[model samples]
Target chain A: MTTLYHQPLDTASRCVRLTLSEYGISTHLEVEKLWERRRAFLLLNPAASVPVLKTDDDLVLVGAGPISAYLSESREDRGAPLMPVDLAARAEVRRLMDWALVLMEHDVTGVLTHEKALKRSIPADHGGGAPDTAAMRISRDNLTWHLDYLDHLLSTRDWLAGERISLADLAFAAAVSSLDYLGEIAWAERSACKLWYARVKSRPSFTPLLEERVSGVIPPAHYDDPDF
Target chain B: MTTLYHQPLDTASRCVRLTLSEYGISTHLEVEKLWERRRAFLLLNPAASVPVLKTDDDLVLVGAGPISAYLSESREDRGAPLMPVDLAARAEVRRLMDWALVLMEHDVTGVLTHEKALKRSIPADHGGGAPDTAAMRISRDNLTWHLDYLDHLLSTRDWLAGERISLADLAFAAAVSSLDYLGEIAWAERSACKLWYARVKSRPSFTPLLEERVSGVIPPAHYDDPDF
Candidate 1:
């Protein structure tokens, strides 16, 4: 069996979980705080970030980007083909996946996670003082634009990249879900984004995400709901 | 011929250039000043980031990650295969590529560029102003660790991912080269990293990079010296 080291609320970690689940790959789940930078974990991944997937063959894969690509590419027949086969379409999927990893994660999910989760655990001197409201405001402001963009993309296509679900959808869903957990997603106004999220939420792979709870942080009541 | 929209000093763009050069792909380079977010550039890439590759068939790739993946996967027989065919080896290459793209860029080159190059352009209201000495100090401090890590990796492997030069090496070299151009890389003490970088810098792909000039910033005298 493979082992996936992850943080329940970490956006990238959630993405790997969705990918693994969508592939129907069973793996041991070990929650990693990442910031602690444990000695053994650092040995496993010098970057000390997760999710780290130790394959059954003992290959240690770190970072969501690598793990997702490895899983999807290496196991062609094991799961639904999350990456499209057509070269142009595959490029589109990869493009959207990069968008989620770079832009969405940085501008939205990263800010919310640091503000809502990690801020409570880190010391004030380490630059984790009271949540930086100004930074959070900027992230939230960017969130509106991102959500609107998603709405625009979804207006013409069923999924982020095309008519069918791909890794891009899962990646976007993972990011939005993290912000949604923080009660940051204003769903009523962004109906298209909300509808897309509902579809993603209904998937069995997303079930695990809904059950995750971080201490001292309460998710919005509708965060895990399939029909909001 | 494909078209590569890039910024001369941008780390990610440099990586794509290296990848294209390695593949012997002829691309017309269009320098992009990302902060300006030109309307036409935004249409090509709403994210308005550099290293956007528009293929001959009119498919527009918006980011370095996607562009590199496309170029390698599309033209497998065009040049030296930068990505390995074996699953595990390919995964390893992808893993290190992500490391350079995400961690290295964020911690070192991104900070140094913002401090050294980008700060001179944007207004204070848009989060650009005088160089942040504190941030530069942090980035420089982080650069030491990064160089050490590269040295450590090279001690065991000829290139970052394995014995042969792969996209990982190109990606990392692209990042460090950007910093080098700003006189940010301290070469003498890190003799191993310097030696390894010399190998990358000597490539024909890197020649174009050495010729690049940003209007107000001058690279160190040794910046383009492959034998340095």
Candidate 2:
């Protein structure tokens, strides 16, 4: 048995969830309030971040990158690999993974999520309050730049990384899903990305994520609508 | 022949350089003025980031994470794997890799490098200007927090991740080396971390990197001293 410590709306956690479900791996989910930085969670992951995976034998994997790689290496027999077999193709997938999990999060998803959703939910003393409009404006601007880039990529390729759906697609989907939940994405202007996201949403792995929500924050009306 | 497009002061580039040398792989290095966002470089890596590795066959692998993974997978026979063979150990190594590549870069290295090093070199029109003292203060404070954490880790483990030197050590050494060159680290306050860094610096792979200098940035007197 495996247990995953995560936050429902955390993009990294969501990416892990999508990867787990895509591979048909069964695992228990435990939600962590990242801001609280619980001692127990910190012991499991010194980074005090979510999306930590602990195996039944007590092996612990922290962060989406480590956990994702662990799953690929240890559980390949359970399902197909989430990355391509070709060396160059695999590098492309990993490159986009960095773009989504690190770069995009740094500029857009993490900023918007913290400003809008996270701030609204947490206590004022614990770094929560009214969303900074200036930060939100910058985040939205970054999102627009990223969405345009994604549209350019999706217009050319069937998936974010390449020919077959891979972890890169899941990582990007997680980012886009969280933004769409916060209603931060302007999808109508990015039809190519929208079409690709719709295709991703129709996957069985994404269904449970669509149903997942953060407390005290409501998503857009069309958030879970695959056709939307 | 492998050709690496890198910026000398770039932490990611340093990691790749160290890794390639550690693996006894000979490669050609080309300097990239990252701020310029050269069109040819952009064509090689759409993200326009450095530490891109182009194989003799013309496959381009971008970013430290993807490029490192590719080298480890493809060139394992050339050297001992920088990560341990144990699955759990590999996860630990990767966790530290993320800590170095993503978290530390976001919090400390990238900010300081941009402010003190990159901005000094790039023209004013290309987003370079006076160093933001406010940002530098925050980065230095963050560096202190990270150094305390590293000191705590090095007090117990022989390396950042575990008993033996791994890619994790190299990744962190890359970050710390860059900061050390910028004279941003207060080494006297963190003895354990300093000791561990000295050990890493003694490695043959680290020597060439110590010799590498950015165009306009001069390192401190103790910057390249393995015994300092």
RMSD after CA superposition, every candidate: 1.8, 1.8
**Candidate 2: misplaced stretches above 4 Å?**
A77-79, B77-79
Cα lDDT tens digits for candidate 1, B106-198: 898888888888878777777778898998998889988888889999999888989889999998998989898899877878887888899
Give per-residue CA lDDT, model 1, range A1-228, as digits (tens): 999998877878888999999998988999986667789999999988888999998999887778888888877675438888777888898888888877888898888899888888766765565788898999999998888889989999988989889999998999988888889987779989988899999999999889888887899998777997
Q: Which 10 successive residues of model 1 chain B have the least lDDT summed?
A: B71-80
DockQ of each: 0.72, 0.88
Q: Residues A1-228, candidate 2, lDDT per residue (tens digit)?
A: 989998777789999999989777899999888789888888888778988988888888898888888878777566546877777888888888889998899889998888878888788999999989998888888887888889889888999888889999999999999999998877778889989999999999999999977888889888999999
Chain B alone, TM-score, model 1 = 0.94
Q: Residue B167 CA error for candidate 2 (Å)?
A: 0.7
lDDT of 2 by residue, B140-215 (tens): 8888878888888888898888888888999999999999999988888888988899999998999998887777
